[model samples]
Target: MEVGVWWTRFRAVLAFSDAVVVLGAAACVPLLGGARDPWPVLLAAAAAWWVALGVGGSRDQRYLGVGQEEYKRLVSVTVHLIGVVALVALLLRTDAPRPYLTTAAPVGAAALLLTRWGWRQWLHARRRHDPTWSHRVLLVGNGATVDHLSRQLASRAHLGYHVVCTWEVTSAHEVDIAETARALVRLARRNEADVIAVTTSDALSSELLRRLGWLLEGTGLQLVVVPGLLAVAGPRVHTRPIAGLHLLCIEEPTFTGATRVAKRVFDVAAAGAALVALSPALLAIALAVRTTSPGPVFYSQTRIGKHGRPFRMVKFRTMSTDADHRRAELLTANELDGPMFKMRDDPRVTPVGRWLRRYSLDELPQLFNVLLGRMSLVGPRPPLPDEVRRYAKDTRRRLLVTPGLTGLWQISGRSNLSWSDGVALDLQYVENWSFTTDLVILWKTARVVVAGTGAY
Candidate 1:
């Protein structure tokens, strides 16, 4: 907590929130004082609040720049402190000031949440403007996993992790750590990396992974595992401690029960609402497509849907009429692969098509797909039949769920990622399907769409 690496931006958020709590507590002392004298009690409560935050890992630098993990811990600590005060008041049998206590509870909670949001705003601004503050990371993994993870980390600037260099091991397959620890130490020094990420897969020796943990304990460098290199999503994998050994269990991707119902509800509500709200914009896009070129307003293509069924995915026509017929000729200039073609500066695209693709307005009609139950509001990207043939056995699992208008692939660089990456992302999405991850992906999709990056 004191010495390890934390995303500096995250640290700033925690620091600001902590300050708010302290200041709020101080402000309440005057109004909340009991008639007899409440100075001691107030001081003690304030002290307990700070101490609990410390014990809860709320101040740990490791969590500073990461995602919701830090906020979860902060909430946990805050709730415990509030509970302690509630219990003490109940036991003492003294009438506490109801107004101050009641007001403070809600106010403090609101402040905590609001401060985190505000801090995030500031952090994002800093990331855009400040170059020196980039997160310095030392990636450690064997062959393929290392390369994949590095690229993933490199592209997500908002996540703030910068891959300075890597400790190249045998690969994600062989986890022999006999020489891995020494290797990590050398790499960390060479790269001046602040953190060490171990992405070795489960096929390797677990003991070696554990020993690498020991090797890192005294190094003052942060240690994090990729959790699942061959798989995706943290929730799909769980750890259990039985008989002094830690066993990792990875469950299959199956959204059922209440989860499935909630997803359907969200999809319908989102898609239904979006279609109704965007009707004017949709009509405008159609008119633009019709007026911009001599072609139909809508472009429809056969894409593989859930369980390997074919469905017509519709978009506003962005390319020339001959674009589809001449796809083969354009494959030579393909910038993206894996059974599909993506040309960065496709000569086939009409000027309007290029602009339409930029902001993803062309995909707005997919709301109809989502409404028809042929696709989801969020899931894996619907692929072409030719693309489906190339999927490895594990990658085929992505078809279990409804296809998506904007998926992990769409949210993360879309046409920019490589062939192997497309498969990995699909498998990861299938394996780690969760309502929360889906929400995050949707939120990220907004940013990617606005940036219009990798659109071609």
Candidate 2:
């Protein structure tokens, strides 16, 4: 089904669900110490809520998925509606029951938000199995940019964009703007495209884009302009209209503030609690490692941390005692790219070590690092000193914050990632660090660990 039709149906379903919640809350009023004759006020409040939702664009197609903006708008609209209701009650001198109003507003809002979240999860699940659920995207730009954007969209399937066709132009100046716009319209119709995404090109002028937007009017085709900036999140990017020009402003990454302090506090509390809670498991792993290998139960390695500081990162020993001594001989057989050394099946790993590595039980000891302020619960993976020495100027930015026990790299493929891909994920995390993003990464990490994929 087309995304537009699916969205329309989804919006209708949401409206019906919201109305049910409002009525359900109204029904609870008398049971929760309120007047039985609450139907009139409850119906009026429901009508006001419906109008507020529409005015706030809570059901807008653009803000439907994967972000907190839709929920924020929903809460905002509900609060405003409640305020208006209270104002009207006051103005009319109607003795509104406080218990009913308080209970109904919160309960109804919670129900509406929960239903929206459930629907979003359903949509995401459908998108994974059915390509038809995605918005059909028509890409237009130079070959390089088109390929780049296509790969990005392909990597994040949950974003609901499926590139149906790509129109590659050597230079936008090669074609007339009006002719190009006409060609796009024809192509979009032919491909049943819901969106036309154009990547940044020097040949395309603002005036040309303006004319193209005009031509696309009434065609129901949404035009999206992709900026050249890579690895930047929405919170750091803003559009400013200066005079007649729409300038895209990029904000610098913030490494200090109350948020950072809160992150540290959370890391300490979570790490400390986890250590205490999992102490029995930790002891069992230690005993197993000690009995299975000649080496010590715990291994500590010097890893580079925030601002070029070095710290001892502890982990369960997963290799024979002579593993480090044998490193030089195995360097030639390294399977990984860049400065890192990795092999799917290394002879140095003991029998128990292999199992520990496979499930990442080896890294559990890093909670101490997090507790001691040497690392965070979530951030870029700590790099070896040798890895840091070989880093490019841009890759060094990952050191701006504390290293992590597990990070984007860990959840996103772990040992399976190539050096470039690993570095990119780390840099992306560093540049777009947020508490919400951390929570998302941690949730995904739990799932990934359970699946035991890409771990050596």
Candidate 3:
């Protein structure tokens, strides 16, 4: 574990920068409206903006450089300041000067965001190898939750937290209220923590939580309780107190409506344009495949789809006509344990076929499936029928969405990933699918395919 000293220090910079930008924006009001004697009004408005930013928690160290908290503060301050400006303009009946007052909102918001991005870039560059870079927090749970938290942070260290130490006892489902409280108190005291992250699994009793909450009240240290919010991003974690009990109102997963329509529209539009753009190349590939081997140019096989439907997924053929019958000969050479088949240099591939598969040009024919709505332009790869057949009940949850031409697994390490790892990635993608995420994956896919990294 380490410290978020940089992140915390950056918060102060953001706060102070926010104040300056507010002052700068307010100053612009007079110049834009051509008001020579507007200094008094500008100063008052600037002062109010600074006060509003502080009140909106833009400078809170607790939210530094993590999740959407920083962004929320940025937005909240902007809206509040704009409200103040609007109220002033309305009171003064300044119709022609309205646009002048509006200038502060976007200008201040952009300034704050730009400042944060620049600071983050500097932080990431300077602290890549620094020992005390990220937040070093005491992880106060003994079981799977702690294990998961530690592994996740370790995997993506730049997200910036180190587990440092895990303090005390059994599984997440074991309940021992008083003893756990004692354990929690001792661990917090021993760690000299700047932050105490309580991973409250079912095992940690509410009494223990309350006890720890009470014991740490006056320590001037940060306390955080993390419920098992699953793959839902941090922005979704909202607490609503109903009848004095804090009820966390987690939003439901909805993959339908405008977003879905947009994705499909993008899919069809892109796929159609690609086919038109690559018409000659596609024809040449087809002719090359037919001449190089006796088999068909394109291949179609049954694959599992959304909601457990079976569909014939299409791809350019990359092996001999009877290669499926020759599988037994290569069975002993298989590198993977589970059902999916992959080898770096399989002898069954023809010269042209090998080149096609190497660059993933062979999978380009899946564009047809995407256009047909049988597959997505970006999503989890359509699992083979046999592959889905072997899936454990939980693993099949990914089939809840249409399989994709490219996905998280494709960009991560394709055929190189183990079966368990592949499913884990697919599930993560399904759970966290968003338009931006899809766009990022599509961009990364080009690089991965070009390099032929981990491709068979």
Best by lDDT: 2
lDDT score of model 3? Answer: 0.76
lDDT of 2 by residue, 89-173 (tens): 7889886646555887788789889888888888888877776878899998888889988988887887789899998878655
lDDT of each: 0.74, 0.86, 0.76
Candidate 2: C-alpha lDDT: 0.86
Error of 2 at 371 (Å): 1.6
**Steric clash pairs (candidate 3):** 1-164, 2-136, 3-134
State the weakest 10-residue window (summed lDDT) of model 3: 1-10
> Model 3 over residues 229-254: C-alpha lDDT tens digits?
75675445688989979988866555
lDDT of 2 at 119: 85
Best by TM-score: 2
User: In what order do the candidates fall by lDDT, top score first?
Assistant: 2, 3, 1
Any residue pairs clashing in model 1, and if so which?
A: 6-61, 10-64, 142-171, 143-171
**Tens digit per residue, CA lDDT, model 1, 146-210:** 88888666666556677888766664454446676777777787777767777755544677667
Clashing pairs in 2: none
